[model samples]
Target: MGWIAVLVMVSVAIALIAFRVLRRKGRDDGDHGASSVDFSANLALAVYLLVLAYAAVLCRDGLSVSEADVQAEAESLTEMYWSVAPIPEAMPVRSQIRQYTAQSIDLDWPLMAGREMSPIPGQTLADMRATVLGLRPVGEESKNLQQDTLDRISEVSHARIVRSDDASTGLESTFVILMIISGLLVIALPWTLGVRPTRSSIIADLVRVGVVVIGVCFIILISHPFSGLGAVEPDAFKAAQRQYDQIDGRFPAQP
Candidate 1:
């Protein structure tokens, strides 16, 4: 992204320099049309701003959706863990939940960043469902708790699949290319004016170019919610881990 931004800046700088030379020669011949050039440059800038704003919003929405999915998945895991606390016979189910959670955090997180799903986490979760369904309840209270646990387990499983799907989601490559093209146009539009190459005019053009470059770079940085520096963290899963640890150490025993 940085390289792309630099390329844009360099290209704009070279174009401005050539425009300056052309304007200097034209000025000697009294062949300048300042009013017309200014009108066209202003029109181009307006269009560029609209495109940039739309692209920024798209990237932000992608990030928000990814974060929401992570939060929902973690909350479901936490709920599933707590639901098993009341029934002693549900200990095996609780242990399975813990294993599934750990696998999701440790094994699946990296895969998510690469927009890939890990088979082991899904298999671990499947085994957890089987363990939950295999439980037999004796009294009415135990039966109720068993049903609640099963519901929560289903919620967790459903959330896990959604998380995997969200992990694979990102801004389309075509949109990114279009944004880059628009950014190039934004930088080059002013040069097309053939306006006066006054010091203030040149400085103002450079500032506008800088702003466009920075904005496009920001859009690129957040283009992928699961990859790069500003990408969403697995803090949700880590919080779930802490909650599990507070209730019981490493692995809970099965009754």
Candidate 2:
């Protein structure tokens, strides 16, 4: 499961704990000490909100960096495609490159998003190398194209390596602990302030609950997009595929 799902489960556990505490307090105090609870709850809620805001910013920056890496890989693939056109017998080689690029984007993207390794990244790399070796020519232009293709391959390979490293890192335990603490603090805050129990007080309690629920939901939604943080760009992948098809059409495979 993704970290978001795990975090959601943690939040639910916090909610249950809060509910039990509130229920017990209600039974013993009979709404006589609502004012005291309210003050404490408000204070806790304020602190939790501040911490959550900071966490959200950090998550956003991390996701942006991840996305940039994917884009870089896409650009490298594009350059590789352009460079391959000058090589002798480029059609078959172009087709192979296109397929590899597409697989990286379409298949590998989903796998990385789930923090899993693709089953065939190695096989794909081997196939690409074979294709590069098959395009034989002795001219300087051909040599340059070969070097460019190698460079592009290296870039994409490095991107995948980085993503693999990231997958293992997972969420920091400290962050998860802080999130749990924040949820608990939010629930406890209202009771500690000794707020009086009245119709208005009950309404205010409901409002606080609503605010916490909304905040949690928003966090979940924002985090959802990051689940695909290390995936390749679909648009750029498609462009490479198109270029591959064009080259294949022009050069037709040998009998």
Candidate 3:
């Protein structure tokens, strides 16, 4: 599931808990000192807010790093495709590389971004290897083309492997858990300190709810750094595909 949904759910759960706590306190006949309760509640809210802010910052940084890594891998693949395109005999292999690279960006990328593993791993790898093998005959005629193709193939292979590994790391789970914990803490802070039922207290509750709602919206808005969840961003994937296309275009012109 997306982080937005998780955030909303957590917010709702916290709100419900807060409501129950308020109901219980309203019914209590004991003379609890309002001043002491207010002081404690405010203090707890401050601490919770501080911790939530820190966690959000940390998660944001982690997501940014992950995105950068994915982009780098895409660029690397593009460069690899272009590097060996100057060889005439490797044209067919170059075409295959282009096709695979396009598939990676157009198809595999969305799946990876959504935290799904590739369904046809064996076939994908086989296709990549086939492209590498196709360059073998041409490599015999030109040592430079052969060496270049070999190097490009290695780069593409390594990038693909790293991408696959990154997709499986389950970063989304960490995000979901953090959001849930933050929501719970937000709600529990007010309850544990026994917030009064004054007009000011009601305003504070409204403000807290508003904060949670805003946080949920922010998470949803930023979920799409390039392309949201399922949709493909052609421009985002362009760097990788361009390299593949350049190889395809150049192979025929060489030798």
Provide the clashing-pair count of each candidate structure.
0, 17, 0
Worst 10 residues of 3 by lDDT: 224-233
Candidate 3 residue pairs in backbone clash: none
TM-score of 3: 0.70
Candidate 1 residue runs with Cα over 4 Å from true position: 1-31, 173-175, 193-202, 249-255
**lDDT at position 39, candidate 1:** 71
> How would you encode candidate 3's per-residue C-alpha lDDT over 88-112 as one tens digit per residue?
5556655665666567666776676
What are the lDDT figures for the candidates, one per model? 0.73, 0.63, 0.58
Predicted model with the maximum TM-score: 1
Weakest 10 consecutive residues, lDDT, candidate 2? 224-233
Report how far residue 182 has shifted in candidate 3, in Å: 5.4
Q: What is the C-alpha lDDT profile of model 2 across 78-143, one tens digit per residue?
A: 677777766656666666666777677667767655667675765786677777877676798888
| TM-score, model 2 to reference | 0.74
Q: What are the models' TM-scores?
A: 0.79, 0.74, 0.70
Over the stretch 145-195, how does candidate 1's per-residue lDDT look in tens digits?
Answer: 778877877787788777777788777776666656666666666556545
Give me the runs in candidate 2 sitting further than 4 Å from their true place: 1-43, 166-171, 192-197, 224-233, 243-255
